[model samples]
Target: MTDTPGVSDPVAGKTTGASSAGVQSSGRTAARGMAWTALSLVVSKLLSFGSQVALGYLLAVDTYAIFALLTTAMIFVNGFQNPGVSKMLIQQHDRLDEILPDYSAFALWLGSIGLVLFLVVGIGFEMTYDVRPLFWVIALAGLSIPLKAATTVYMAVMSVNYDFRAISMAEMKRSLFYYVVLVGAAALGAAGYTMALALAAATLFHVALLKRATPGLRLSWKLTPRRFWQMTVEMRWVLLSSFLFALGMNGDYLLLGEMLSAEELGYYFFGFTLVANLTVMISMGINQALLPLFSKLKHDLAQLRRQYLRISGAVTLMISILCIGLVGIGPMLVHLVWGGKWDPAIVVVVSIAAVLPVRLTANLAGVVFESQGAWGWRLMTLIWDAGFILICAFVGATLDGFNGATIAVALQRLVSGLLTFPLAANMIGIAPRRTVGFFARCFTVYGAVVVAMLLADPWRGVSVHDSTLILRPMLETAAALAVFLAYNLAFNRELMVAMLGILRRKKTP
Candidate 1:
């Protein structure tokens, strides 16, 4: 109930020297954690990308579509497995080890329930859809739930210790294992079942490594009902929040599968995968590292607000650049890599790219809300997002098919960002206008880049049939990059300089 040692209550609007020192220390640790996470993500995503490319080439579109559907269902079920328990563990600054046994027990129980639920649902899905392979893949993947749940507990322990290096290493191993298994299975002509098998194997291996990495940690089946009940009470909103967020994010995949053809869903899945990869690189790479740090600073709203803005700005800049790059060259990249067979996915990718900056910003806001113990607000935001996107997506799918659904999804994201930004800002005592100004400045840069891209479109006069596909995108990308650099230099020079200075300091020490 009381503020942690060296943490000042935000309402007091004051801090001692010790609190300031504590804040600085936590900032450094968070930076280090983020660096490790970034490294892990870069390596893991590269492997994942390679696997996806291989699978894309090896499997038929309809087969890949089935895999994507089952994978999404597995992930949705996993989302319910002790949703906020890990976060609750991370938020605690004391008695963590004392609490581990009960937490572990709860996680195992939830995971068991999740596994059974997934099997029941998978069977029903098979019966209803008459897709036998779907049930098999889902059933096999369901085996990983308990392992993943156990891994989650250990990862939370590592996070509380600020030991992200171990976590990153475990992730790298998991990715490597997955990559090898996926390629081997695909090569053996397993099709969709390849992904399901790979996921289960990799998750089992990952849990083993995580257990080894976390010293003195052992899985327990002993549950303390009182402690479990207290944690459940504390985390009920967090669980709801997690479920709603997952529904908001992944519900579209389900919608597309049900409402559209398999080929259409496949195309949408490819584009969604690309966008989701970029998002994971930004959101999980940066935001997860910030969780522990924000928890440390939650009592000091001033520090938390400052850190949130600075980090959000930097993340916005990175996401904006990636989105712009995607807009300028993503279609060509798709053609070059996956061949023109995936040309249908190009529009979907571009539509999703339109809202990446806003979606990512809202994601960061969710992190802030969770860190500040504002789970109710976080849940409300997620509910609004889920409702808006599902309605828009259904309407769009009914009217104009997959492309329309893509545009509708992007619009929903923009609307959610607009609605949530001010609320998140206000929760931290930041003026809503300041939040608006921040995004306005960020989007101004984005808008300039977009206009420059339009003006720099190298294929404007060239016929698509005659133009050199590779050369056109390359030239256009170069032009867009040059314009972006010029704009930033001319207008955002100070911000650039400050970022460079921070990097310089980090390198020096």
Candidate 2:
């Protein structure tokens, strides 16, 4: 009967009936948004995986490296432009239509400046290195920033409206078009111009389609100095945070590539890609609706506290079970399927997977920060965590090479996760101990079950060559997952059911 994600009397009887109406309305909106986002995510992930496979098949390894390098460069280019600021549109308390024009103007100026800066850095790299074709890739691919900037406001508008159906379909279609173009180019012969053109084409296409999605919305050339300055102040922290986030995301590749041999780095990438992609599919997909939902309840502290606990607790429970499942099942499947080609990375993969409960739990805290417009607080978490990750990578690589560095990456996430707990608690005015204790209990229950099953792993003796090697691990994984689910149902049933109910298909009148 509760509208919020209640766990053990969330502000028990403190909420008025008027506040409860907002909860019920938000729950419904979140449910619909989540459903579309999930659909889009599944299709997009499949397209992404397929495109990579297709590209790898069509292009030679070295040929594709150029494409990959350019892609990385483009991400940095976008990051430097403080792309995260555009998302501030979703958190604005003002009327969106009133502000959209000014915001769009701000985006134009930001994007133009960004494109110029990207050109400067990129051209410098190419000139200094005397790398052929690099300059064109840099110039052409950089156009997407300006193009994307033009549409960022509209995108934010849709997100605030929770019209995820529009956003989701646009993403899937945009990705599909991009891959199709990229793959076609690879088939002809991989070229930098091809990558840049494909990238630009996709951005323009999405912009055009999104315009159709919001027929009344259009870009305007209107900006006030006060509004512009205010916008800058709002985004200053998040801009730096975005850059640091990009650094943390790609730091492993950059650092490991330099320290380790090509083959060794390849193994590390293999492990990371597997883990990161799974994280994106599960955590990011589910949490996409949080910002808009949180923004709606930002004024309602009692409801925010309850919903935050509900979502964070649910995420913790799910991630704990998933992390253990991946560890339990990964080795057996890798050995049997790839015939141990990736055996060297089993430890690297397992080490990263081991910390998922915390890493994922920490991500939920971000929604609270952004929704409350605590951009500086969000930036602090990123600065400490992202900086620590790179520092740990260096020390870890020096101490233990690839394995050491990856494990260090896991360690940095745990530290960050711990840091996030207090920040989110303080910002939302919830008890830190209560939030921390809830997360801890989730991990403990699932952790004990998974550990017990690992200890009792009966089919440990099965040979990798035997097909039956997977059966026991699979069963044990299933048993642990069942226990985790059952534990939630027994003790945390209301929160679990609330999440399920939100995600359930509601009958329309």
Candidate 3:
């Protein structure tokens, strides 16, 4: 090798060639995985949106509120119980096959604990609040915890292997099954109980599919104590962050349910869901991919920093445009879609839509923090944000009812973003001044668009009840997007170039 294994050595050349081929193959696999995942998220969101539309029309406001409340409670419980063990399994660089049994066992134990906690809470709610219907619905839905836990274990295994195609197929199947049951139940005139029952059925079906897809993943209750403790230690902050974040997001719904009538809660929930869906879609599509991508580059700070800033900036620009456009046309779309029944939600949508970009930025930053294993900082940020939202929501609801609550929610998002952006930027090696300047420019552009829309009065003649309800909103949204695109091309050409570069990289290998 002294003289033969140099640059011109045939064996060395073959080795280099094979190494290059391996890198190319890996890149292709990653690209395909991301594509499948993105497609899955889009399809799942569309299906869920369609279901919401159908349910919005089919169910009474109070019924929808009850369903929303139950689901919100379920989310809160799940968040509270998340130990992040599954996430640890995904992020850990070990042989997953060796740990599968232990992970399964831990998940099963956790599920049992969650089930007991839910039952106790249900009883307490029945006793304290005396909301019999809500208590029963939550109690029945709580039965799905074990099924969900099992599904999570299987999903973690799949995710670690980058088998996103399997995950996507499973998700699509679950969504389809759930919607079928939901619509059928609604057609049969079932109320909140329908949601509870559908959740149980869908989860059971999902677990069955997971078992079939992932053979030999038998649920175990034999967790190794040492491994369990290690996971707990690793995931302690993640669990706290999850719980606090969940409380921040869902605590308002619980408060509103307690203070307001079901119908009023329904109106707020509808508006919140509509506006929040856009944020969720963006987060799911982008943030979900960021963790794995960032993980791969964790050793390269410069590359990570460049990617973080570019992606975050691009996300901000895109979301700002969407939010500004929605500010112009959201109310009209709501009117056209749900008519007079949901007209009360218009103000809520407008207020909440204004906060989407801020909230999304903070959310995306959390993904970056997680990828870098910056758990303590993430926890602190989440705690601060959650506390702010909780206090603001309580005060706002107390002061001015639902609309005030919506405003408070928006203000909370704004404060959270302002406070967290510097911290996130610092962790990612991005300068605070740069982050602030970027957001300022985005805000200025968004503000200009809003002012222009107000001056134009695009929705003055549109009527929710009229057949031509979609025309004005469509025209206005299209015009707003066109103008925003032109503005970006002129002033933010660098952002566009960076975005294109990102796309090219994704396609290159």
How many collisions per candidate?
0, 0, 0
Native-to-model Cα distance after best TM-score fit, residue 297 in candidate 1, in Å:
0.4
Q: What is the alpha-carbon lDDT of model 2 when measured against the actual structure? A: 0.68
Off by over 4 Å in 3: 1-34, 216-219, 224-234, 281-287, 317-325, 440-443, 454-470, 493-509
Clashes of 2: 0
Q: Candidate 3's residue-wise lDDT over 76-185, tens digit each?
A: 56743455555656666366777777767877777777888887777766665424487888778888887787887777777666667787788779878988898888
Local distance difference test values of all predictions, in order: 0.74, 0.68, 0.69
Model 1 earns a TM-score of: 0.90
lDDT, candidate 2, at 118: 79
Clashing pairs in 3: none
lDDT of 2 by residue, 1-509 (tens): 22344322264535455455656666667667766765776687677667655653454333433443454465465554446644577777367767777778888777887899878867765755323576778788888887788766766777777777788788789879987987787777755466787888999999888888999888876777787778778676766776777665556555555566545665666566556666655544454577878887787777777777766665565467667777778667555545556566666666677677777766778778878888778788877776787798899999999788878887887677777866887677776667666766666686577557557653252344555665778877787778778878888875576556544633111
Where does candidate 2 have its weakest 10-residue lDDT segment? 1-10
| Candidate with the larger lDDT of 1 and 3 | 1
Residue lDDT tens for model 1, 360-439: 78888887887888877988898888888789889999999987898888788778777787788788877766777777
Which of the predicted structures, 1 or 3, would earn the higher TM-score when compared with the native?
1
Candidate whose lDDT is highest: 1
